[model samples]
Target: MPETPPITKPRRRDLTLLGLAVLLAIGLVVVLVVRQGGSDPEASSSPASAMSAPSAAEASATAPIGPLGDLARRQADDPMALGSPTAPVVLIEFADFRCPFCAQFGRDTKPVLIDRYVNKGVLRIEWRDMPIFGPESMSAARAARAAAAQGRFWEFVTAVYDKAPARGRATLTTEALRGFAATAGVPDLARFDVDAASVDFDDAINADLQEAQSLGIPSTPAFSLNGEPVLGAQPTDVFTAMIDNLAAGGPANS
Candidate 1:
């Protein structure tokens, strides 16, 4: 396996701002504190527990939206995106393939979002490769883009998350990623391999990383729902309600 570059941790200022951004974007003040350790126990336990809304105390403690600029890059024909470009709501996800919470969201909650909002033309989901987990994470992000070149980005993502182990045991070696490409049914493995290592994909992945850093996002599975920030791997219903509220012309923070 080819060696991937070492990953660097973000600065303390960035982490502080990320915490504030979560408070501003989503109303889950308590969840942010808990997520610092790992996936929340309640969220990791089951889909049902994950989807339930936070208590009144948590909800009322919501922070004001920060300076996380216009997050929606609503470009038509974006390969790493799903749904109409003009959908009422855009859910921009900053995720790492190696993050267990990201895997949880991808495996457990994403399909539901796709079925309910994306299929209904009410939401557009755009993926941003925020690979904070080092070489393996960056390699997987590159591989995913390579898969996107063959029109199987989501398929590749599903395959990876489906096989992802518990947090801290990521299996994103180049060989393993190639196996994922096969599982995702990429027709040309040769082209996939080349594209995964190309300068183009590297630049593309870096762009996403820079964007996340600019917004002070220090974690995976962070989201921007039509410019509203939502941190952590929240449940299906929480996402559904956000979409529904947006569709009904409710406030982004509602």
Candidate 2:
């Protein structure tokens, strides 16, 4: 198997400073995102947990988000990524399988983006696993990677989120994840199970998680498109407008 790119980890002493800052932000994220990931009554239809993506005009008026562009790995063989590596606009998504809003984005807006942009060679999507809900969420992330090892990452994504509940975290236990693997057509079930049960993939997963934490990403389904932070499961038009702006040459990286 190809190696997962390593994210540079901070020195152990630096964690103190990082943790103190992440503590407050994560607390806010847990509270705000609980309304979207757990038993919140209004999670089904609201984008409340998200950070709010700007319209094309707003994006145009803002200063170029040059530094944020570094988040795009654009690794050609990265199994968790989609579309052309050289696409003009690259969208980085940080999400957890157990997050309802992530499910909503997977079920709704993502397909449109895939069809309208990804398929047309204008956009690339790179996924980062942020398993914030708990161990089950973490397990699901691992299981998804197991499928990725067999070249079924996107299929696993669709199976896991395609029929998930719109208002709460999905059931993502080992057994349930195995079922999802089946639905995703992972060619080697035994291998998938073993890999899912192993800790070998945690580094890549944690790297993605830490990157999101370092950025103070408030919740799941958050995105950075051509380096602009867009929090939430935004509307299709919002993403479309942004893509159009980028395609029209809004930023150097876009």
* Candidate 2 structure quality by residue, lDDT tens digits, 145-176: 99999999999999999878979888888899
Candidate 2 regions off by >4 Å?
A: 1-67, 251-254
lDDT of each: 0.81, 0.84
Q: Against the true structure, whose lDDT is highest?
A: 2
TM-score of 2: 0.73
Q: TM-score of every model? A: 0.72, 0.73
- Per-residue error at 91 for model 2, in Å? 0.6
Best by TM-score: 2
Predicted structure 1, TM vs. truth: 0.72
